[model samples]
Target: MEDKEFDKLTPEEKKARFQKAVDDYNSGFVEVDYTFRSVASIRVEEAMEDAGRVSEEFKPAQIKVIYEAAKADLNLEHYMNPKFSASHMKFIMEQEMAGKDVTWLPIGKILHRSIVDKPLTRDQIRRIKERMQRAEPKDSVIADLHEKKKEAARVPKKQGQQKKKGER
Candidate 1:
């Protein structure tokens, strides 16, 4: 309603309108926005604990939203070579400080796939990248193993699969 029209109403009519709005809100007819909260309002430690306790069956989207909000509110940045988010690191730190199990959180595992403390050294990454970029045939060891299997398969299976004499 326009302010002018509302101002024209009697006090009793205004009260009735306010009551109807409240009723609509209470009845789920209105979506009351609760997203105004800031990350500063969150207790990081508590959020970590709660996240740790999240059920394994919870959807990834749910976890993502929760974590995304936490990350945004804190204005956290990614860290380390693998680019782990600050929110993830904070949660792990909180769990560690409390002596809680830090390894098995479903959300944590989803958010940080590697979950490694020490990131791979630059040399290691460089070597891996170089190896991947190489034009040589890959999997030499597996290639030999597969060749051996093919050779074995090519040989006919003798009756009873008897071992040759003196072949220990």
Candidate 2:
């Protein structure tokens, strides 16, 4: 689209246009210059920790909106390296930060199988969500310990196991 054509669009229309560009990028229509990341560039993830921090003024929902807006701004600045807005990206980041196995998330499957491609399937996503909900934020060592405690309780008591057994 020409500058004059884009200029005529209202703010909302312009946003929609940019969003389409992002969608196009995500669908692999618009190729991203991976080299740009190697160059001095601001990473969205670097700011995520601070962004996700819930201040009295800013909440998680508010941060997400801000992050999405920033993504649009980044796309405007770096058209060749547009940011792909995946709903799972933030979730993955948070989960990974808490040391959870994000492999379960069907991020391999993209969201919308549009005129372009969707990496993930809805069925896969549903399955992943179910697993996540059932696990209740499964952590690494934490999960192991929790399971061990439950199993220990089930085992038949043999000769009274003391709390802190250390012979003098």
Clash count, candidate 1: 0
Model 2, residue 100: what's the lDDT? 45
Off by over 4 Å in 2: 1-41, 44-85, 103-118, 136-168
- C-alpha lDDT (0 to 100) for residue 35 of candidate 1: 38
- Among the numbered candidates, top TM-score falls to 2
How many angstroms is residue 151 displaced in model 1 relative to the true structure, after the best TM-score fit? 49
The TM-score that candidate 2 achieves is 0.24
The Cα error of candidate 1 at residue 44, in Å, is 25
> What ranges in model 1 sit over 4 Å off?
31-168
**On residues 1-168, what C-alpha lDDT tens digit does candidate 2 reach at each position?**
669998999999999978977886564344345322311123344444444532234445544544553454332111111132244334334444455444443332343211112333445446666555555545788887887798799998889756776753
Candidate 1 deviation (Cα RMSD): 15.9
Task: Assess candidate 2 and give its lDDT.
Answer: 0.46
